[model samples]
Target: MKVALTGAEGFLGWHTRVLLRALGWPDPVLIGRADLADAAVLADRLRGVDRVLHLAGVNRGEPAEVAAGNVAVAEALARGLRRCAQPPKTLVYANTVQAGNGTAYGDSKAAAAAILAGAAAGCHLVDHRLPHLYGEHGRPFYNSVTATFCRVLADGGEPELRDDRELRLVHVTDAAAALLDAPPAGPWDAAMPALRIGVHALADRLAGFAATYRGGDLPPLTDRHDVRLFNTYRSHLFPAGYPIPLVRRADHRGELVEAVRSHGAGQAFCSATRPGVTRGEHFHLAKVERFVVLRGRAEIRLRRVGGRGLVRFPVDGAEPVVVDMPTMWAHDITNTGDGDLLTLFWTNDLFDPARPDTYPEPVAAA
Candidate 1:
């Protein structure tokens, strides 16, 4: 079914788009700032869509601006809905759990919900009251403290917590799933805390992840929350912390190199590719994958799902290095040498054909 999405470039919006792509859902009609400002444009965009995910709003501005901005978008959308030739079947508003809490943002969110409800008279209105969301590529200092900490730590800087408080954090992907009505996403209450931790504890936990990962080793991802946190941390180090050189010890015997070392569960496999053969052209939603060249020269190329430029890395088996793939980025490795190319692949989870978590996308595409 066709879907229309506002705030399509925001952190949560991007994750929703990624989830939709992973699920093989139809492309969404992106409702940008221009569309939101013009009711006629928004109406045209949402006219025949099966679902409308309203995710745009201002949350980090002056109290008055924040409240007014949030309500304005809702009013624009309401106007658009009324103008639609065929209103969307469902309208999901990404409201926060703090709705109606008397704060400017909270009261504004509550007002937005009411406005949408009145406009979407016949449509199924889902006011998804989400909690604190943290995920990959979230804006530092703007999205959440998790993002800020991750960015500071990843950039070799320390993070200082001003006021420690409890946070009910949820992964953006999970939030995205709930917004999309995707399967395995059970009924999530407005304030369901997937993982609850104090500010200090969260900072320490993220610090531990960074320290372990800095040494080219995966930390103990004992559960889903840990994995999600680790992935979020790793997201900040992409295209910079790659090609992790392995410690090659040479003594009396042949040189030895540690290819895969993880404090978590994973699967490893090797592949031999003929010269000029490309091995992968896929992206993972949450899988942490690593590629190590063992016997030949190759070029590893990666491109973000919705990006245009390509990131190329030339690798050689003679000097082994680990290149971990970031989530949602399409990647591929090709044998550039004349002889057979040997490569080792490692993932954070065992292969499950039923749920491979892999999606096909060419890295060469712009």
Candidate 2:
């Protein structure tokens, strides 16, 4: 469907754009803050748009400015939509959970929602009262505590949390998905999937992740939320803190080193492959697997299930490197050297005979 989105440069808007593209939706016409200030520009942009996602607002500014800015943006959008030849079939407003509170931001959001509902005469309006949203690349010290914490920890600084307020955080991706998945609405209230935790607890969890990950160890990914949080935390450390060198202990008897460490890891196994032999040719839906070559040389190949290109990584036992397999990606390893290959494999979950997620698929399509 043709979509027009405001706040396209913001954190949540960026994720929504990515999700829409991943879902094969048409590229949205982005309406920036300046465009919202201009009725003609906004109206022109909304001309043939099928859906309108209104996500622009001022969260940080003078109290009066914040309140007026939000309401004005809503009013501008309403006016633009009314001027359109065909109003969008759906108008989704990104409201906050604080809309009912007595605070200035809350009052403004509530007012904006009301304005949109009134102006969206024939169109479906869905108001999502989202909670504290967090994800990769969120602006630090702006609104998200997760982003600030990640920034401080990644910069080798301590995050001082004076107020241990309870926060219900929803990943930006999940919020975007919820917006796309919501059905046509006539003034409905909804919330995205969130993880509720105290500020102190959240800080402690992130601190633990930083310590473990910096030490070249994989932190415990007990649940999907933890995994998402870990990924978000790591995204803050991009370009640096990568290619973590593993600690290797060597002796006259032989060298021994820990390949992977995870509090939630369930199973570990080792495999031996003869020269010119290949292993794996399959993919998993949820399992997290790591392949580490212990002896001989191998080439690990991976390709997304529906993708055409394959990614190949040559690994050797002389210098161990762990290659993690992503979900929905068909992967395999082949013995590339003249000698036999010895590989160690670790997975987050134990192999279940009854409900195996492994799907046979060639990494290289014929």
Candidate 3:
């Protein structure tokens, strides 16, 4: 579908564009804030556009300015659409869940939704009210408390929580999907799926992740939400605070280091392999596994089933690295060091002989 999207550079806008592209939608005409002020420019951009996703608004400014800016932007877009030779069939307004509240931001959103509803008389208008959103690289302090906490913790600073209010946070990717999948022509709030947690609880969870990840251990990802949150937290640590060195304890007896620790982990094992020996020639369908070399150099090889080439990663005990095996990839590890190899393995669930997901296949065809 030919689409025109406003605020295409913003957080939600970026995610929405990604989703649209993934779904095979054509490149959307990006409308900037400046374009909204010029009816001629906007109308030209809207020409032949099948859908318009209105995602721009002033989130931070004087109360009166914030209120007026939102209403004005919507009015401008409507005026542009009126001038279109063939106006868009659908107009999606990205409103907030606070639209019903009496605050300036809420009132502004409500007014904008009303303006779009009246202007696009025949076209489908979706006044989607999104809740709190958090994801990778959200502006710290301005966009979300989650982002602020992630920034502070990543920088080795403490995030002070002044209020312990409850928050329902939807990941940006999920929010974008909801917008793309939204039904047409109703002044209805999209039931945005969110992960509800108290402010303090959320802060604590992120802090725990920061600690574990900084200590060179993969934190337990209990579910999809945990995985998303973990990724978001790590995004803030880029270009710095990365390649986190593990805490190594050495003695005359030998050295020891913890690789992975999780309250939710169901199984843990260690293996010893002689030089030139190889282990693992299989892939799992549902199981999650991580391999950490502890006492030798090795090369881990992986290839998707039916794929031609292998992806090789060389790991060494001197500097431990964890490689998480992905599902559907046939993989194996070989000891490349002169001495015997010691490796640690972990999985989220205990192995069941009856339902083991392992299927043996050479990473490289012999």
Candidate 4:
């Protein structure tokens, strides 16, 4: 089913997007706030979408600005849904966990819910409410407790607790899956705390999850067998729901660099692996790249920022050719063939996020 998702690049939203795709839904009309002032324009843009998941808001903002910005976006989303020729079957509102008359963020969300409730006709309105959500994508606040504790512990400082700590915690992927899986809520489920947890326990739980994750190997090490990967130092957490790049097969295993590339930029090497192996969900910018399946087979998928209709290629050794991909197009190469698919890659420049390169975006739907 078609859907409209806001804050598509943010932690929760991206997880939700990934979940929806996993559930066999098409890519939703992923949107980031373009203009809050023009509610009508925004609404018109949202018109005729099947489902609109609103997750745009600031947890920490000047109370007035936060309230106004949030209320405005809700108003615009409602207008957009109303304008839809066929009202959406589901209009899921991603309300914060701290709802009701609690903090300013909570208060604003409660108010936004009111606006949305009024806009529904036959629309199923489900308000996904949860406490601090935790997971890989949640780097800062939502994952604040985990992030803080992890940073402190890694830096040789024990995590400090502010006595009497209590709060609900939801895994980001789990919460996102819940939102997508939540059928239109019955009237009673509106603005309800569907889930909850405590602060100290939350920290302990995350720490435990981190510790036992990937069989008690911790963050950087994927597995104990790869322990000899003495040079491997990848800290990013690949939450279960997302892609886990099969980087450097055992044969090429010893050479894994944290740096994107060593040579200038024009050179690159990617994998079209053994029939059962996969490559990655990550890509680089400023890298004029080319991919060639030297053996076996591959399914090369490419996508861009706001574009629809991914470019798909299911190639085999019988017909192997290099595909040149410009920076605007972020791509992933997979070995869908029965044998090892060796892919040759060449890049235009070295990796540099500051040079307007390397966007850590969602991998295409499998």
Predicted structure with the largest TM-score when compared to the true one: 1
lDDT of 3 by residue, 183-220 (tens): 42211113555788999999999999888776656677
Task: Give per-model TM-scores.
Answer: 0.96, 0.73, 0.70, 0.55
Ranking by TM-score: 1, 2, 3, 4
Model 4, stretches more than 4 Å misplaced? Answer: 35-44, 141-143, 154-157, 182-198, 201-366
Error of 4 at 305 (Å): 12
Q: Write the per-residue lDDT of candidate 1 for residues 19-66, one digit (tens) a residue.
A: 887777888999987887888888888877999999998899899999
Predicted structure 1, TM vs. truth: 0.96
Instruction: Decide which is better by TM-score, 1 or 3.
Output: 1
Best model per lDDT: 1
Greater lDDT among 3 and 4 belongs to 3
How does each model score on lDDT?
A: 0.88, 0.79, 0.78, 0.55
Candidate 3: deviation at residue 187, Å? Answer: 27
> What's the residue-level lDDT of 49 in candidate 1?
95
TM-score of 2: 0.73
- Give the poorly placed runs of model 3, Cα more than 4 Å off: 182-191, 246-366
lDDT of 3 at 194: 74
Cα-based RMSD of candidate 1: 2.1
**Per-residue alpha-carbon lDDT of candidate 4 for residues 90-203, written as tens digits (9 for 90 to 100):** 878888756776767788899999899878588888887766654432463344565565544334344677875555544554566556664322111112233354567645
